[model samples]
Target: MRTSPRAHARVALAAGAGLTLALLVPGAAGAATGTPNVPTDLYNAYQPCATDPNAPLVVAGRGSGVTVEGIPRHTSPSAYYLTEQFRYWPVADPTQIATVERTWSTPGYEATADLPGLVDGSTYAWQARTVDPSNGAASDWTASCYVLADDTFPSQPPTVVSPNYPEDRSSQGGAPIHLELGSNGVSDIVGFQYSWNGVFSVSGADIGEHGIPHYNDPFDGPRSAVRADTLGGTASVDLMPPSPSWIQDLYVRSVDRAMNPSPTYHYRFRINVDAPKITKLSNAPYGKPATFKFTPDAGVQAASPVVSYTITRFGSDDPVVLPAEPSGVATTTLSLAPGETMTVSSLSANGWTSQRNWWRDETDTTTTVTSAQFPANTSSPAAPGSFHFAPKTETSQIASYTYAFGWSDAPTTVPAGKKGELDVTWTPPYSGWYYLVVHATTKDGVQLADTYYWFGVN
Candidate 1:
């Protein structure tokens, strides 16, 4: 039907974005900024509001240009119907919505309204409608929001690129597919939701279903989930696809709620994607303050991000390691001299890694007390036997420590100790034989024997 020009409607999953494209025409001839915008694709672009800034606004995004729908018919010879409505789904779905100016008029149409916003990690459906009175009647509404993608959705998403082992993704198993992901443009990410159809891990789903872990090795087993976002980039996961196993369908996307997404800016993981490798690691200067460097067979990432490199010296400050490039080879400096050693480790480029990787414990106050003596109280005749050892950092085997007491006849693995008096205190597993052996290895064994020795009570 014949109608007057009017404002269009726009419905998108997100609504906080807009652009003002400059024109090639002269300043006098060009359209003002934020005016009635015309686009190549009328399906996605609708007038965000009615009677907005007169200056023409430029639209930019996927699918070429924006489009306007539901032009309004003239309501009267001097007046026109301005068609308008809110950009939203038929039923209230999980989305961010806002009122848009949808109208049609005789001369032209325009709108001014606040844009709607959507929630993260949610699915949203939207459409547009307009109200205009150019030909004494307004036309019907139009369907939008279901814009088609020119290319197929990514079957294999991006992934974290390192710290993967050979047995991460095992099927038959040979050399598993290793994948890692990192984010430079955004903050750290967490709890990745991933999947594999054999070769690839798919991501971006809200539920954790359909995603797979990159556990390719039986020996490698379950390591604590390293929060990928702790690094300078957002949190990213790393895994190696098992060898011999054919990873046909794999997917991975990370969010607190598995596949659900929060920020538009994020990093994904993919398999069969090769990045830089660190073949060699060394510390030069080997002085009290050593500067460690790594030469990767493959090039490093373009960025100069720092990871933590820990070494043992009498005293020194820690330094953050930086990545050479996007491919992943990273390095840093350390200071050490004769008789000193530095334990190398990684710290998240961000504060996150501090909790898990940045710090190390060389001595144990609660843990290395090989033997101890407590005061003989009147509670029991046997003094409580005690010893301390720091918690194990890397080993996962069942640790069994035995404590020998002077009075125990059987294996008194862990018991209390007493002095010349008949009282004694010891460790918990009080079942085996124990003897108060006068430990001769004091100062010899880090002076543990002298500080940790005492005559036992019978």
Candidate 2:
């Protein structure tokens, strides 16, 4: 016989009261049967509830939901038809439920409820109960299950703090770069997604298993993931590739539980292992300074501007520094000795030093005297023979030539066009032997070849 609504209501109220009484009097329900026929499934009739679901794992704004399973109240198969009542409330105030949802099935074993319009990053509690459809028999509410909603994306992009950040130029053997990141005050950051040569952007079609959308064009391969509750942290990465010519650009973005992404941060840099080239070393005369000219390596010039140059002379530890001018040429004056070895190296604005080029100074100032002539032997009071001086080569290098008769007397200067020769008539006062000498000097005042002649007087 079908039960009236009023009768059903009374039966449900009585059943609820009886379950409470059964708890208070443990053996009362079975005592009437003269045997302890206690209902083993009595707890199952109480309500359907989730077993230990972690809410923090749920994607907040992605319409994520949890499933609650029913417990049997009695051994009768008909009891499985009971209707399930599920309710959820914010943890802040459990007295009021934010939403109530109901579901019933032929077997009525479980219900997958939807939690719509939930605030991101909030804590909530949920509970469930069962009502018998035949007689309106209701069970007690189950224990509340607490969940943490983590749907909010990080507020700021991660800041890069290693490899000198924004701009860097280094040699191939430089130390691995330590990439540092920081949180934007959002503690719910689940992990980070990064691309080596690209930026991060939201994708409309690529959806994750949790119903959250993933970023588009993560890269040539899967995006790298770093899991952490707090995003702002650090990691060591090999910024330099195997070859110095391989440059790198990095982009990173933070991801929340809902897969929402933060703005992408970027870093750009290159490896310039090759040093600059010393193109020319201008020859300086004996007393003048030499100029060293250099050109940066092609890779270094493309990577960044050359800031300065260092010129080192062989046999000296000190170096001369020259600034890189607008012409892409760096020049420095060095007072170098003839045949001295000098090396030139280039420096980038970012502090990368190039290899050095070595060359020898070629300036020369030596005068070559081909021949000198005077009387080999002569008697005292004899007339002095003609004296002639000739240069074998580099006559332009001659500054002046001199002719001298003795050590005590000053020599006479020979004009350049005169072929370095002088004619003199001198009488030896009382000489056993009179000496004649010829000296030649370069234009720079460097003494060159000297010739000597002798005469006997009696």
Candidate 3:
């Protein structure tokens, strides 16, 4: 868009490092709270030749902020604009000598120019000419100047490299966000905080009681908007249910210590929730006897998430959902019937059906766990019955880290349609959570269960 000396107009526009834009509104852009600039009458014939020894440099055209055509440097890059020409100034002049700026322009030649001046966030208009030592060919005056940026008001925005210009991206429940950000221009990065829908759940499955996944904000310092460790081109974080299965248009926003946040980035994704997978079966290592807890080598499908399940002895039509006193996503203990069979399955999200099966109808008298086959986190210290559960989650934040281990005199019974509770007891050799592995049970001695979970310890 070209600007004339009549209406002082400037529109709101974003600028890239090497690109410049001049808004031609009657006022400045983004100044929703201010008025636009009015064009002034520039009838000055021409700027006199420079008195300095330099020959290629000509006086830039004049205006409130007559400035250079581009950034000034000792030498020009490959594509720098040497100068320009203009039609008669005051546009009202008809017989003017085509108004060549530095007299270097050909007769009847015209020029126009836009320039960003010394002020960091301001722009001004003026014409410029290039002089050649050999022939002194001055180009016509150029006008229509523009300024690139003015981020000095609220705070200094981070100088992010090209793309990853924005701090955060959006994601859904099962489909996580793979963030790639470049912080080459930023230094002294303390770290970054992530808020999805809202800040991540810092209490529960996240860092838990362990001194990790901590959060202290306004985050008062200059830090990368992403995380300190996420500079290696890629970072993986799982998307969990804020509303879980209830889908919504979610967004991610990040800020620097200067509190300059990238514009909110958003996307549309639905949570793909499946019931947690129960991989194998066994007995608990430390938790109470079989009646209270039955071990199941369970795993969550990396591609699919199973949120809930049901557990019952074989041949029993009544199978109670796990997580006995289920609050959120949970696992539960099913009481064993001496001669009865057991069945465990991954429950569907829209509600349950026989569609998915995790484990099924295995008799207690037929089940057994070789002392050597049991993981030490549960059985190592017999008095305490140490055990370990490998609990893997499909989430990026927290959730799959808790374990249900230790002996509960009364095997917490999983009521019909509901799940049971796994007793928690911290002992030696085992430092975290562990639940029973129901799949380990076999047609041998009556061991019924063992503690083998899907997880990792801090």
Candidate 4:
């Protein structure tokens, strides 16, 4: 039988269609072949552009004109088409997804899309895939690529100020050196890096990968960059040195989230740690002036000349400023009661004060004689009249009183109540001048008070 071209074509078409269906089905084909090949080499070429170390980390507006490129694939060359899938979320989180899609014509390998509204400075992920228009089959999605959309740099450097002036000269022992850094014009200041060294410089490579400078040794090491909000409106640091020495220089710089660093600022100072010393001289007798000598410490001389010294009493805070003597030695006279204590400290020309030194007056002896009455200067040959007098009130606690005549007889007790008057029957020894003296003693055996009357017998 002769077959027509149309009938023969039908037979071929039916066989080819059956074979194609068999291949498209999962279990009946040599290879499951309807699905399009997965897209390859997907990438974001310019939409959310690559980060430029010199540019700001966060851009101001939404990212657009995001060009995504890929290799479109398909089982049948004529069916090749592309579907670019873009997904975005905060770099901080990826589970919550926002998506947009763009379709390409057959053989097309690239697509331009828009991230309509995205947060500034945020990073997002995107991907693309291919599809077979003939079988309605889609390829697996391409690998994801990340892009950041930031473009603003911190505009101003931090303003560093210190209430404690001459920070270098102020010793750590005196008070902690306090510093305040103002966030000037920067909208976001992440943290600060500071160093104390002998050298000062404005130019140096960024210490951290983020562009912050390292605070090298001699100073404490590099500090990790902290969040800007955590630092608030102003950042602060307290510095204290263990001993007295010259703090030659201090350097500081500020940084933002974009890794932008501010110009370095510097401060200079000389530390003074030395205070003055107070030395106690021999104890002064009661009623005599007690003397104390003040001397400057070695550190005082090393740091600066002692222009003047301030001496403060132990019980009082008021200071007495005195000119420094030719010798570093200064003496002050004080009269104190028995058992009373005195303390004094010295202040240097630079206003550095020394630790207070104390001195106690020696227990008082030799009582104060307020009044006395006895025979006249000249007495007849007979015995001198009886001694009489009103007793002086005890200024300090008194233990006992004694009466004596010209040092001839042993001291006799004048009972406490008898202080009003005393009868003297003893005759004066043959002497041109005789003295009748009364003495008072404290419980500690200190002679606290005494008085005497003199008489002459011709």
Candidate 5:
């Protein structure tokens, strides 16, 4: 439990913080039977950003609100304040931006007021008080809570420099790289947060218990934060990247004291020292499974035999792990579409992993439908044209061809000829560009990928 604001304020005053509070006697004119206690626990009411360093930087234009609550006195004769008042104003100018009053027969009610708009880079202060509308009596205002309205991101990204692994160049892997993070003209920047794989979580410094903004140890939290030197605004760290790639990037962001994050600075470099070699073992036609082998580098395999290969195929973000054979080589069969590629990384018996190696398969993607009478995009409106479709290969046995003039129309299907050839005729619909999609169903009941044909009806 937190200390009562009355007691805490007393203590703060005793400690010579120059704080003061007004006390009205019970007999004062039109005063309530018992005085309402000054409000306690004033903070940014936006729960998502209410915690710690985030509270101090209120996101302007997001309907951010402030909250303050009053705890009723528990004396024998309790006071029932009928109303609560909450208001916030610019810190520099005392003009009120907004104010809210709530009626509450019960005490200890929370008052929330929304800030529909605030000037960027400006600071605002808020306070709350309890009042008795019938008697026109009110408690002294609570200590003010301050928040900085910051709609702007940090000015710029962190200035990054690396000695061991310079930018855009290859360097030996399996060792830590020295990096120096410096400020980029953002005066309030306190540290740099970075990650090897561009995935990161955010956190900030804890605010003082009294809702006062204090910067005593802002660097204590944040899993990836590196505090800069207080005087020079620079810090150095040695970071080791796991699972190197042909082009590795250390994504870094500058974090201000208020926890505002800057744009990412991609610290790019290469670390392809001991990657596995990819070789095509067999060539199968498009849409058919083909075999490829992954072998570790000679020097790497001598020390630690390859155990498995991690392969990430194109069109998919997930990686698949394939165990290696007894000969320290791994092979996998994959059915890939034309122009698809995959990246492979090998793990060794000694728990070391090689860098990523890229491989591409040569799969033919020739269009099965061709037209001579209607060379693409040249036919006028109502012009009739004939299209011819043939099997992809002599071995491929297509049953029928299903095609549609455009996405909105119903598709028409025609049986293939004895020799697996298809012929169709259609009149142009309009003098504009149009597209036709065709899907071929193989005799084996497997549907191959769809082919798109684009042309214009002049």
Candidate 6:
């Protein structure tokens, strides 16, 4: 009859004369050879919710093989070599599925067994025990570890909806779009996998030689997932496609506890959120017709070509609408009064209007006065020269001139002669460079652009 190691030890002690027999009869039948310690710290890929021991195992699919590992507990007689025996069988059938034996003589006491007969929709139970190699003595079987095999994916793909963007329509881009994903009655879903531009991959990290990761290898798979609530399978994520104007599909799929992926669901939409490009003439003449070029932005040109341009001038509510050329560019000649600004916007074929581009004319065309004695723009303090101002045209109606000799000095107004000419005598207070600012005003109280004159007194 089989007996525990402690019971055999008591029997040997009671019979002191027979102690040698008890210790040397390891190979004899019904001998009191010691049984090895039980295995511990079981591990396998199918073990789900590892923190919770009672949780069931979830495999990816049918015919999938898994590797199980265990650490054999050290027993008495440290010199005795030990091995491990593993068994697995489906809970539905009493017949044993497989039994594997491994001799792990290394110091770590680790034993590994491969399970290859797992099928779809089946529950499996496995256990491990340590054995003494010399006398075939074995430890008691470990408690069965249960696993649930699942090959079926979630019944449907995750339902994806966006509030800011509509399906199959053009919406404003360049901003984050809020998306809500929910499982459509398939409760097994635990997370979601998605990708922009409809490209999805489930490829794992590249395996190196000897099943060891290289120093520069990636840690995980190329794809990523977002977890959902354990009970409801609901999640939300903000997605923003590449800027400019993007027209692409957002692909999403549901992932179950077994890492099985569902069918792909396409969320197609177009985005238009770039301001139109404005190419206006630099320093356009005031009160004169100048050509302004309007072209669609690169993003808009790729998705929805610009069909027209809307030009809105400051101080006037009326917007001039012009048709764009086949090249998505429109040019218009319009006059802008002084101190006026304009804005241009492009309209695309999808009826989306871009942000406005501001424009202004900074041309100077006011009456100018020329200096006679200061033609060379230089003078000396000893040779104080008189300053002479003369109009370029004889028909000039300049009534007065406001002149300032220095930046810090106030301006002095002087009436011009009947011939539109003026003269001012000035003596230098110091030998240094100086600037003169002059303004001409017509009889109608209209101020012209100021003229800057520089002179050096050395």
- Alpha-carbon TM-score of each model against the true structure: 0.24, 0.35, 0.22, 0.28, 0.45, 0.46
Which of 2 and 6 is the better model by lDDT?
A: 6
Off by over 4 Å in 2: 1-84, 98-110, 120-122, 130-139, 164-177, 184-190, 197-223, 228-247, 256-260, 271-458
Give candidate 3 misplaced runs (Cα > 4 Å). 1-177, 181-193, 198-225, 228-239, 246-249, 273-458
lDDT of 6 by residue, 71-161 (tens): 5554555534455666778878858557765553321344555566678778788787776656767778787877667778777888999
lDDT against the true structure, each candidate: 0.30, 0.51, 0.30, 0.50, 0.63, 0.63
lDDT of 3 by residue, 278-350 (tens): 4323453222234233222122323233445566555657767664222224444443433344545444343
Q: Of the candidates numbered 1 and 5, which has the greater TM-score value?
A: 5
lDDT of 3 at 392: 22
- Model 4 residue-pair collision total: 15
lDDT of 4: 0.50
What tens digits encode model 5's per-residue C-alpha lDDT throughout 1-458?
Answer: 12222332311111211112322212212233655566554545322223233345453333333333333221214454345565667877886446555444345433433454567777776666766654556777766666776656787888899987899998655446789998888877778888877875554223333333222233555446688886338889876666555678889887775456788899999875788888878766556688887887775577567888899988788999999887778888887665688888878776767788887754443437787756665654557888887766643566777889888879998877877678889887677777778876656554555777777776
| lDDT, candidate 2, 1-458, per-residue tens | 11222221211221222112111212111111111111111111112222354532344434534332333233354343344455666666667565433323223233323454556667666665654445444456676665556555678886666644335664442234456655555565656666775644442223232222222322224436555534444333333332223366777777665566777877666654465666446544454576766877776665567788787778888887888985557766666655578777666665556556677755343333221222466544444435445555555555677777779878887655545333444555564777777766656775654666666665
What digit string (tens of lDDT, one per residue) describes model 1 on residues 1-458?
01112212323322322321211111112112212212111222332312222222222223422333333223233433243443543223434343444322222322222223332222333434433322222234443343211212222333444333322342221123344554433333334444443222222111111111111211123532334545223444433432212233344443331222333223222333222222224432212233344332211111223233333233557534454433333554443332443333322233111111222222221223344453222122244565443222211211233334454434333222221112234553443333343221111122112122333343
Q: Give candidate 5 regions above 4 Å deviation.
A: 1-35, 45-83, 95-98, 101-111, 115-117, 132-137, 195-222, 240-243, 275-353, 356-458
Which run of 10 residues does model 6 get worst, by summed lDDT?
Answer: 10-19
- Give me the displacement of residue 232 in model 1, in angstroms: 35
Error of 6 at 270 (Å): 1.3
User: How many Å off is the CA of 179 in candidate 4?
Assistant: 1.4
Pick out the ten consecutive residues of candidate 1 with the lowest summed lDDT. Answer: 204-213
* TM-score head-to-head 3 vs 6, winner: 6
How much does candidate 5 score in TM-score? Answer: 0.45
TM-score for model 2? 0.35
